[model samples]
Target: LSVVQDQIDDLKISLNISLRIVLIGKTGSGKSSSGNAVLGWSEFKSDLSQTSVTKLCQKAQGRVEGRRVEVVDTPGLFDSTMSHHEVNEEMLKCISLLAPGPHVFLLVLQIGRFTPEEKETLNLIMKAFGKDAQKFTIILFTHGDKLEDYGLSLEEFIQKKCDDSCKKLISDCGNRCHVFNNKEKDTERKYIQVRGLIKKIDDVVRANGGGCYTNEMLQEMKRKMEEMEEKFKQEMQKMQQRMEEQRDENEKVLQERDNELKELKTNIKRERTLREEEQKNCNLFFHNITIIGPYFQKCAKMNQSFAQK
Candidate 1:
């Protein structure tokens, strides 16, 4: 019983090993289809149109071969139709979805369809994922039927047909590659390929000391966001301070205006009193003059009358 319990504990430890994978590519490079294949179901929307279908980062989780698997399907990273700003916004979403970080990045490519558009796809991937991304990346090729039809293996195709840029991309990814045929009706083959891909990822994780891929770019982004938050707080404090100062200044001006108004009212009252006093004095003088003039006139008339007598 003790041995059985120990085995159970070991199994639990193995089961707890989680694998986080992020899929990236251009529009219609079979990113969604590859994600569906990896999940062993049609959890993601896959189409063959030239336009982009997945507009955001979508995550799906399931158990694969006793290991927990989480896949994040991101929008096309190098869609020419999308502006740089739009691509950047989507890339940030992808990074956020992979939070903490991703263990592997599956760069999907369609076999026999490597065009100039695809050539620049790697540059975009590196730009988005950072320089150290190649260490944690795997080149996943879709449309395996093309290779089967041509009777050539992925190795042969890469050696004989791939351009300099494609070869360089494969070399950058440590030559790690896997092929998948979503259109294949063989369930057994699909399962085998998915298992093989997972094994490859496990080997990569082991090689990297069981640590996920992280780069200066991601760290810089986090740093910038922190700095931005601090800056915003400082700016808000400054704005509040300015507003308070303005309020104080306005209050002082209002107080000064009120004081001036009160002084003007007092001056007006004093002037009015002075005017009233002057009017009263003038009236008294006129009244005295009238009384004196009448008395003088009567005296003069009496003198003239006595002389005539």
Candidate 2:
């Protein structure tokens, strides 16, 4: 009974364990096909077009060798003619699809098609995703038929055909690479490739402390967003304070003006009263002068008559 219980418990634990992978690359680099091959089904749309085929991110879930596996297929990272904003938006969506994050990033590359543009795209991926991405990244090469045509193994191809920068990129990824031939219909080959890829992913996970790839760029973005929110809050507070101060200043000015108006009115009333009093005195003086003038004239006339007599 104890042995049976332990077996059941182990099975449960195995069922709970899952592997998440995110595929990223430029247009026509066979990312979608590679994803389908990895999942052992045609879950993602694969095509050979002059333009980008995968316009959005797609996620597919499956069980491989008793392990739950989830693969995220993303649009080409750096499609020519796409604006930076558009690319960034799509990349952000890819990250969101990965949710908490991915266990490994499959940087898809075409076998024998490494160009200067592809090199630049790789650099862009490193720059945009951050340096930490390399720790959990695997350089997945698609179109493995190219290797057969050249009669070379993957190692031979990388050694002879790849340039210095390409070699460095592989080295940076810890030389973690795998080749898949999506065109091949052999079930055994497919199984072997998928198994090998999953094993490599397991190895990477174990080597990296059993943790998924840490999205430092995403974390940094979150931190920056928090800072921006804080800044916005501070600015709003400052604006509110300024508005309050302006209101108080305006009230003070209005109060001062009202006080000045009241003083002017009082002065006007006082001046009017003084003018009235002055006018009354002037009237009284005018009346007295008229009567005295008449009296003086009569006295002068009497004196003249007495002198004549």
Candidate 3:
């Protein structure tokens, strides 16, 4: 009886285990709705917008089938409005939000609406997250209602209507895929889909030897970010230092100019003093000449009158 009880306890613990999942895809790929569906609640904002709705990476937690699940919703990759840098920052943020690492990456795609952008979805994901992320990825197709409306199973749609690239994407993901009807009204049906998804997630964790995607890549990316940040800091510091040095050099040049100007003013003042003294001496000599010339003229007149007598 004790052994049976121990086995039951172990099963309960397994059922109650936690899961970390991230949803990634292009804009308008139903990532937000899919995240809400997985949580079995409307934790994420779902809407129809011409632009990407979830602009940042956000995390929410809930219990699905008695298991704790963490869902990280991210903005649309390759969004026209968002720059590549913005997307990378968000990707890093997603990595951090998942903390240690995510157990699965749900590459969400919309059924019957494959476009050119959607074709590069997987490649973009691998580029942003890393190549190894593919091993932990699961292709999640939303808008299952569309498939239901056309009376086609998910697999049937893939084989009949999906293009070669789409098929290749599925094959690359190891044929692991699931469809979600986010608008379903029946609780039991929603539960079944979510349960099936959880089962797939369990399989992935098991295949990985019960390990989540390692933090090695995340650490490497972070180290790169830190390096970039450090480099930027160094560049800014060098620029600032150069500016300060230039300012000091300019100040020194200005000081030299000021000193030269002061010396020029002093020389001008000395020259002016000398000119005044010379002018005074010339005026006095001219006055003495004027006085002596009159005296000599008077003596010459007296001598001439005496000789005539």
Candidate 4:
């Protein structure tokens, strides 16, 4: 019994050390661009030349502000030229890169083009990715400019345009939604979004294993499953007790994140207003300068006439 217990302890430690992240989206939705954005290096080819060139899995590795950020750009599904089986094969091939499971699925989508075809394709994403996938999905929307132009916050636009099916699909993974505008060119925004993704991944791990996992769990060993589940309950109780005691601290952390997001939105709004005011002042200055130049020239001509008289 002692030896058996020792092995169980060892298995749990191994499971906690591994991290994997996979990227999925339709072609031209900016998966490759976002991948480069996350990795902070243009490791993958991002071309908009209307070609189906991504034949297989491409992986990029980097340190995202201290976290090991690994990204795999998978060949997109539902290509007009490819058959369903081909798409499935390519998707599975991508999954093979991150073997057992990925902590998060970054499902990229376009700004204003969530069409019926895309809707059907979105359903296929769930099927190919896996069932019970909501527990590990994040809806990443691209095109920040449009949302800002519409005077809609990311939260508001998601509430309005990101429909129930989209909600159910991603919320299964963890209610993680990110809107990325390719044109915005802000590195900090990308970092912030990636940080939130990592946070959701932590939540998924905690919820699933109760802070205990192992290769045996990965292998789906039934005997180990029972033992782990039982052990998980005791550990969960301790965590719950700690959480209950420190509920206020946890709330404070969440409140801080809310405040940060509000400040980001506020800053964007302030910048837009400043640009409009600057343009207004620039036009006014140029107009007055033009009129004053002509007036001075006329005054000089009148002085000449008076002197000649």
Candidate 5:
């Protein structure tokens, strides 16, 4: 009975693992600051130049409402004045190592200026990931002080800049977006809001990745393999078509030669038959003719026949 009870307890403990939330955005988006805020400690390095603070992913493990929360900080991605495509590629490599897979995407941004570049970054993220991204994403806008003086709410700001791309991203993320001011005094309130966001994202994580958040890596690899297979198949089809066309051309040439051979054989047979018929007619005429004359007359007749005939 004790052993059975121990197994039951183990199952309960396994059911309560913390969720992994990954922070992604351009440099100076305040990801490190936001991570410090979330973890309630200055464990991660923050306050770097506009280029980037977090060169690699740094993880901070913490507790909120009796559940463990993992915060993954990443470097800036696709900053026109800052990072390059190589940088983004490197960050993906880092993400693969650090988080393996993440249940939530915390996109840090400044409130006062939702620049076109920032919007584009979000679009890029969606394009890279695919529809699965919708399950585990929440927008976390930093620099809330910039919004204090502004009268418009976050939804209003999004609506003002609504396009098909932005609309689709919002819709895919389950209409989940949050704005947090790192410098604000009511940080616990923001934490509660963020806590809810984590829970929501966790539900998606369990549903999509077989309770393993790192399944994105597997899915990405699978997608690449499928693309390669399709390309290979297309090339094989082209090769087969070329071979068929060549075979048809070769067959046509052989058929023409065969026809010419048949015609030549027919002409030879007709000429041979004509020659035999003429020989038979000449033999009959020679047999039917009778000549008895003097040698001189015969010789003259034969000479004349030879000359005339």
Candidate 6:
């Protein structure tokens, strides 16, 4: 019995699942940089630019400490270049990429550059994902070197230096946070930070009972897409049917007009023929009257002379 139980436990251990992580943040928050750091190499482009570097949802995967990890980098939530509809579409696209869904969402933030959009990020996430999004979120602060330059620990900065909104954000995320210094060239230190981040991720997964965060919003979007496609097909069919019906009706009308025109032409020709014949008859009668007029007069004179005698 002991041997059998040991074998079962070994089988269960081999079933350790992979991690699917999605990054969310405002533009210029070093989301791409953090993703590269997590994967211990560069899989996404990172740079200093006023414009958003990522315009679409992109996914990259690698092995971290012998565990499979997938990172999905998304466009900034409040990028000015993108409209509201466009941003929502990209987010939905991100959700679709991580179908059935992400085990954790790393809410990327800069060390000391929290803006108004950053403050409203949680609200947006709730609006997009749901209220339960907070449960599966982990706050990830990039540019750790800045915090080091300030000579402040992560906890100290949160308690003393960070603004009220930032503090509230951290609190809301259950104080589950990690910092990454992408500029750190020391492989050991980078490895340590990545390992720590992964540990927190494992904790989040455990807390959620080994289940990923699934959103009804994703399912709803899919349903809407299907409905719209079906509606478009139906509309196209109706338009084609209407066009075909109109074409047949036009042909019928044209045929009737053509028949009516032919009948009118025949009637006009008959009337012309009758008029010509009547004119001819009148001309003949006048000619006959003119020829007999002289003859009649001579006959009348002879009859008068005979009576006198």
- Please state the error at residue 13 of candidate 6 in Å: 9.0
Q: Can you write out model 1's per-residue Cα lDDT over 222-303, one digit (the tens) per residue?
A: 5776798899999999999999999999999999999999999999999999999999999999999898998989999999
Writing each residue's lDDT as its tens digit, candidate 3 over 48-138 gives 6648888899899988867789999988878888997898789768777877788899988888888888788788777677677788899
Off by over 4 Å in 1: 1-16, 214-217, 220-309
TM-score of the candidate numbered 3? 0.66
lDDT of each model, Cα atoms only?
0.81, 0.81, 0.84, 0.68, 0.68, 0.84
**Better candidate number, 1 or 4, judged by TM-score:** 1
Worst window of 10 by summed lDDT in candidate 5: 204-213
lDDT of 4 by residue, 1-309 (tens): 956754554455334444566777777777788787777778888766445546577877877556566677877656667777777667656555665556666777777767555566546655555444445556777766799887898878767877876656555546667776766567787677667656655655555542422323334444554688889999999999998879988899899999999999999999999999999999999999998999999999999999999
- Write candidate 5's Cα lDDT for 1-309 as tens digits: 966755554454347576677787777777788887777777777774676666766777887777787777876776445445655555455346545566677777766555577777666565555445546567777876666666667687667645666666566667777776777777677687566566556555544533444556547855876898899999999999999999999999999999999999999999999999999999877665633346667789889999997
Clashes of each: 0, 0, 0, 7, 0, 0
Candidate with the larger TM-score of 2 and 6: 6
RMSD of each: 12.3, 11.4, 10.0, 31.1, 11.2, 11.1
**Cα RMSD for predicted model 1:** 12.3
User: On residues 240-280, what C-alpha lDDT tens digit does candidate 6 reach at each position?
Assistant: 99999999999999999999999999999999999999999
TM-scores of the candidates in the order shown? 0.65, 0.65, 0.66, 0.57, 0.59, 0.66
Task: Give the distance in Å from residue 223's predicted Cα in candidate 5 to where it truly belongs.
Answer: 3.5
Worst 10 residues of 6 by lDDT: 5-14
- Steric clash pairs (candidate 5): none
Question: Could you give me the TM-score of model 6 versus the true structure?
Answer: 0.66
Off by over 4 Å in 4: 1-18, 163-174, 210-309
